[model samples]
Target: MLALRARRLFDGQEMRHDQVVIVKDGRIADVTADVATDVPAAVDLGDATLLPGLIDCHVHLAFDAGHDVVAMLEPPGLPDRMRQAARQHLAAGVTTVRDLGDRDYLALGLGLGLDGPEVLSAGPPITTPGGHCWFLGGEAAGEQGVRKAVRERAARGVHVIKMMVTGGEMTPGTHSHLLQYGLAELKAAADEAHAHGLPITGHVHCAQGIAHVLDAGFDSIEHCSFFTEDSYAVDHTVVAQLAAADVVVSLTVGVAPSPVPLPPRIQQRMAGMREALRAIQAAGVDFVIGTDAGIGPPKPHGVLPYGAEMLVENGYAPLDVLRAITSAAARVCRVGERKGRIAPGFDADLLAVAGDPLSDITALRRPLAVYRMGSRATGRVGQINQTAPTIG
Candidate 1:
C-alpha cells in the first residue's frame, strides 16, 4: 500500500486541491481530503498535479516519428522499427495507446506486456481493393472477403476492427475522400465484426463518407474531416444518429504533421477541422482525441499531449482536454471501467506532472513519475534517504 499527497489531482474530470490518494494492489484504494491514513509509505508531492495516465486513441506502433513514413515501411526492417516505436511511446508518458493500423498483431502483443504501451490494436486496417492504405496490404473486396477478414482478425485477438471507408490525404494515388465500401459490403463488415464481439472504427473524411459510416453502424469514425467544395459542416442528422446510437468519433484533429506543404484549398479544409470539432461538441457527440501519429510526417506514436493541447486551443477547457486523453479516450476504447479514472478497482496507471496541467497544458510534456500497476515504472526522483525535488 502507498499514499501519495499532491498539490492537486485531476480525477478524470475535475481538479481537487491538497488531496491524498491511496493505492493498493495496483488500484486506487481511496482518495480523500481528510487526514492521511496508515500506509506502508507516504510520498508527499508538493506543488504538482497527479493525473490518470494518458491514453492515445490512434497511434501506429510500427512507424518511426519521421518524414517519409511510407519509405520507412518498405521492407526488411518493419519488425525492429515496430519494437522501437512501442518503447518510445512508453518513455513519452503514454501508458496506453490504440494502434489503428499495423502489419500484424505485433502491437497487440506489446499491449499484453510483451513489450510496451498497453497496446490495443486492430491487426490491420480493412480497406477496399487498392483503396487508401493499401500499402499495408489489408485490402478486402466483397462481403465474403470482409467477413473473412474480420474473422481472421478476431481469431488473432484484435481488440478492434478498422475500416477505411474513404481515401485520405496521406495515402498516395487514391481517390477523393468518398465512400470506398458499398453499403452492403460495409454493413456486412460491421455485422461480422460485431458478431465476433469486436467494434469497428471507420476512416472517413468527406461528408458523404461520414454519412455512410453513420448509416453502416460503425463503432467510431476516424478523421471525419467533413470537407466540401464550398464550406465545412457536419451533417447534424448524422451527428444526431451517432449520438443516438452511442457511437464515438475519434476526432483526429491534430494528427497531421505541422506546416506540411499543401494546396491552399486543402489547407483551408484542414483549418476547419477545429470548427467541426466544436460543432460535434455542441451536439454532444461522444468523441476522443487521437493523434494519427504514424501516418503523418514526424510520425511517432504517443504524441497525444500535443493533440490534447490542440483540444484546449479549439475551445475545450483544460480539464476536459485531459479527460479527452484519459476517461473519454478509455470510454471510446471500451476500457472505461478499467483504465480511465483514479478510483478503486481501476488500474494503477498514473502520471505526475511538474505543475498544475489545468493552468498550462505544456506541463504534461514533462512527467515527473509514471506508475504502472502499483509499481514505479519510470522516472528519477532520488536515491534512498533523500528528498526528491518538490516540483518534479
Candidate 2:
C-alpha cells in the first residue's frame, strides 16, 4: 500500500486541493480530503498536481515522427522503428494510445506487454483499392471485400476496425476531401465489425464523408474536418444522429504550424475547422482529444499534450480538455470503465506534475513522475554531494 499526497488532484472534472490518494494492489483504494488511517506508507510530492494518465485516441505507432512517414512505411525495418516509437510515447506520459492504422498486428503484440503504451490497435485501416492509406495494405474493393478485411482483423484480435471513408492529403495521388467508400460497402463493414463485437472508426474529413459515416453507424469519426465557406455549416442533422448513436469525434488539434502554404480557398475552408469543433461541443457530441502524431508537423511521442493545450486555448476549459484526454477518450476507445480516472478499482496509471495543471495547462509538459499499474514506472531523484569540498 502507498499514499500519494499532492497539492491538487484532478479527479476527472473538479480539482481538489491538498488531496491524499491511497493505492493498493495497483488500484486506487481511496481519495480523500483528509489522510486515511492505517496507511502503510506515504510519499509527499509537495507542490505537484496529480492527474489521470493522458490518452491519445489516434496515433500511428508504426510511423516515425518525420516529414516522409508515408514513404518510410515501405521499408523493411518498420517493425523495429515502431517499437522505439512506442517507448517514446510511454516516457512522455501517454499511458494509452489507440493505433488507428498499422501493418499487420505489430501494435497488438506491443499492447500485450511486448513493448509500450497499452495499445488498442486497428490491425489495418479498411480502404478502397488504391484509396487513401492503401499503401499500408488494407484494400477492399466491394462489400464482400470489406467484410473479409474486418473479419480478418477481428480474428487477429484487433480492438477496433478502422476504415477510410474519405481520402486524405497525406497520401500521394489522393484527393484530401474526396469520399472513397459508398454507403453499401460502409454498411457491410460496420455490420461485420458489430457482429464480431468490435467497434468501427472511420476517417472522414468532408461533409459528404461525415454524412456517410453517420448513416452507416460508425462508432467514431477521425479528423471530422468539415470545411466550409461562409458559416461553417456541418450537417447538424448528421451531428444529432451521431449523438443519438453515441458516436465519438476524435478531433486532432495543435497539429503544429505547417510550413506549406494552403491555397486561398482551402485556407478559408480550414478556418471553419474550429467552428465545427465549437458546433460539436454545443451539440453535445462526444469529443476526444487525439493529436494525429507522426503526421505533418506534429512530432510523435510527446506532442499529444500540445493538442490538449490547444483545446484550452480554443475556449475549452482546462477540466474539459482534461476530460477530452481522459474519460472522454477512454470511452471512445472502448476502455472507459478500466482506465482514465483516479477512482477506486481503476488502474494506477497516472502522472505527477510539478505544478497545478488546473491553472496553467503547460505544467503538463513536465511530469515529475509517472506511475503505471501501481508501480513507479518512470521518475528520478537528485542527490547533492554534501561530502564534496565546499566553495565559499
Q: How much does each candidate deviate from the true structure in C-alpha RMSD?
A: 6.1, 7.0
Q: Kindly report which residue stretches of model 1 are placed more than 4 angstroms away from their true locations once superposed.
A: 34-38, 111-115, 229-237, 240-244, 255-266, 379-392
Q: State the lDDT at 263 in candidate 1.
A: 45
Candidate 2 residue 18 C-alpha distance from true site, Å:
2.2
Best-matching candidate per lDDT: 2
lDDT string, candidate 1, 276-335, tens digits: 777777777777887787654433455666677777777777877888889988988879
Each candidate's number of clashing pairs is 3, 0
Model 2, 1-392: lDDT tens per residue? 88999988887767888988889988898888767778878889899988888899888877776656676777687777776676666666777889889987788875335235688899879888888888888999899999999999989999999999987767766665778889999999999999999999999877888888888988888988764323345777767766676678898775444444443454576557767777777777778877776654344554677787777776777878888888888888888897888888888877888787778887877787777777775423111111211122
Candidate 2 off by > 4 Å: 34-41, 111-115, 227-245, 256-269, 379-392
Query: Would you list the C-alpha lDDT of every candidate in the order shown?
Result: 0.75, 0.77
Give the Cα error of residue 371 in candidate 2, in Å: 0.9
| Global lDDT of model 2 | 0.77
